[model samples]
Target: MNNHLLRAALDAAERGWHVFPLRPGSKRPALHGEERCPRTGECASGHRKWEERATTDPARIHRAWCGRPFNVGIATGPSGLLVIDLDMPKNNSSSDTPSGVTTFKALCERAGQRVPTTRTVRTASGGMHLYFTAPPGVRLTNTAGTLAPLVDTRAGGGYVVAPGSITPGGSYVVVDDRPVAPLPGWLCEALQGPRRTPQPGPVPLATSASRYAAAALRNETQAVATAADGTRNHTLLRAARALGRLIATGDLTRAEVEEALSRAAAGNATQPERYYDDVIRRGLDWSIAHNSPRRPA
Candidate 1:
């Protein structure tokens, strides 16, 4: 057994990340298969999958890596991690294929936000993984293309091969040593989505500026709710853009507008909430930028 592999496993465990062994030079788990389970040890109760068997126990780490130079795999869900995968396109020969890094930067620009700086890993295949701690009380699942093309996230029910793992392609290595950052609130909002709850009923209001804005919101919310299947995202964007004016002028808060639009769009949603979220966020950002408050004339 390679001492380096053992050390790597120990290092990950010390950081409080639950880890399991991967087959040497591969991403697949090295743990026993249920079909061939001896029905002993950890599986005595039942066959625990690799995720369940993952541990931060030093003794377990040493014992597991003693027989072979197994690669390390981090169970992101158990570790409270959300890793954003920024990938290089497989067919790099095509100019049209954008790298994950590029698309994610464009997404940040669209949201009028900066790309977060955090601990990062360079994958064996030359991709980047930005590590973040998931917010408390929010359990997110693995996502594919929820952010942008060639980008994915690993959270609950997904795992990431730890740095020091090697494969035929190359070795995973840490590029940034910074501590993992908390998942951004905007991102959490995008992935977790608006809480599913009963919609509020109509209430009478005075004919004021806020009332007009509220009426517009109600009308556009209805438009989005009744949008045709093929036009849901488009309708969501338009509605958000219209409501953003109220958000900018203090007639409404961005939070309320977001909640309103998200709730309205949820009924007609065909794509993942993240996709609709991206649409609404983009529209609101555009409106805010173009309709910034002016100084007294």
Candidate 2:
């Protein structure tokens, strides 16, 4: 790696961040060039490819190329770094929403922690990247899979929040001086343990039904005007409640609940004009299905 890039990575390490050097050949194809290898001009390794030189000597190549920016290296400061990639949801309706950032902030708030920087590493698409430095001796694997859904790891086209890896040219922004906190003990402990078989929790049937009914009412109101007092609405609402109860108690996964809701709404469609009703039905179904069982009154 370039001395500067390597130094930056080391600096990050000193600050308690984990560092991973980008492979010499990992850059996009267009960036490749016939530069002399750092090891040897005739050497097979770390030569000829722009990405290879960039990876091997990020600072030099970055200054020389001045075209494509460098990917950031993870800093292995006193604390290990937590790298996160922000991704856009596939659905166009919700595509513009800042769900990734919202989710990240929400989780951090819930866990009583904060990210280290607001500087975002922009993706090829217009998504933001955030980074956090964990306390000393903290391990990333401790929360790997559990936190997987919340952030992209860049292993499969997603970008990781690292140094030199994020440059301003590709719509990337690197925020600095943000506060970061240690991961919560409960979350760390839970993540460290083996995945446990999901269990059904005791949920009150009536409460589940009520929550489902409310969710259905909300969906119907959003999709259609006032709901007519009728058997169809009542039946749909009942199904929603049942699904909600299953969801709240961990009896059904989110995917299973969504599928059930889709099926339920499909059966309830009365007219082509009310196609949106199907969407509402599905949403309500999911809402109810995921409702947690109520505690004893």
Candidate 3:
């Protein structure tokens, strides 16, 4: 085993961060208990929820790092790290104004606060993981595209690749390497906003608008066809915009609908990455505007 990962693990432990050994070149755990093991039916390695095995114990850290050069993973909630993941455009675009940056700016405008400077990590894909200290009594859950398609969060049960970890794709490097800042009030409130949970008693019937919206979404997803190179973006945008309008009425959650849209867009002969920048992002933005709590008169 190379000393690099071992040294990184020890350093993380020294800093009081709960750490774990991810499989070499992969994010899955290196040591999974029997019941949840992925390698074999009998707990050889790779746990289902590997975050549970994370610890700050030096002895365990030594055992993991000593055996193999595993990638280091920091347990988010346990380590008090709330990460704001801003994924870059998939086309490998290096434009000064990327989709993630644009969306982040829009988010700040909506929230009325700027993101405080803190320890930021640049991921292998050129995206960013903005680290923040979780607030007391705030149980943040992992969410994808809740704020924007490219904006994700790593909270209580989530984990992030530590800065020193190397992967097959690339390395996770610290950009600022500064202390983690506190979760700003605006950002925290946005994350902790009221969720739509299933309540007891009879399930509310889907509204007519919602039913129509769902049917429209299903129809669009099923009808996705091969798109020509020039028309791919337009094709996906049309479908996503229609779905977004339905989503605006509370007919479906953004994640579920986006998944369907993604699968449909990836169908046949079309690539999903081609539509992310101009199609998917704009479609969702349209939905957010129409569905916002304060609807314009």
The top-ranked prediction according to TM-score is 1
Q: How close is candidate 2 to the true structure, as a TM-score?
A: 0.35
Return the candidate ranking by TM-score, descending: 1, 3, 2
- RMSD of every prediction: 12.1, 17.1, 16.9
In order of listing, the candidates' clash counts read 0, 45, 0
Per-residue C-alpha lDDT of model 1 across residues 1-297, encoded as one tens digit per residue: 478888888998899999999999999999998898888899998899898999999999999999899999999999999999998889645877888999999988999999999999999889999999999998799998988988999999899999998999999999999999999999888887655544434433333446688888789888887787687778888888888887788777777777777777776667888887888899999998878788798
- Model 3 alpha-carbon drift over 4 Å, by segment: 33-49, 91-97, 194-297
Q: What is candidate 2's lDDT per residue for 1-297, written digit by digit as tens? A: 355444554444455443344433242333324553355553455454321222333344345334332344443232344445655555654555555656666666776776435435555445565554444554444232255344543221122434444333343344554654443554445345653322222222233345554454345323222223354455555555655555556554445444444444443445452553455466556666466555699
**Tens digits of per-residue lDDT for model 3, 1-297:** 458888888887787788988889877767656574566532345434566678888887887788678999998988887899998877755565456656887888877777578889889878888999999887898988787768999988998888878877798888898988998887887887754322222222344445576567667665444455576567777777777766666776666666666665655434545545446768878867876577488
lDDT value, candidate 3, whole model: 0.74
Which candidate comes out best when scored by lDDT?
Answer: 1
lDDT of 1: 0.87
Question: Would you estimate the TM-scores of all the predictions?
Answer: 0.68, 0.35, 0.58
Query: What lDDT does the true structure give each of the candidates?
Result: 0.87, 0.45, 0.74
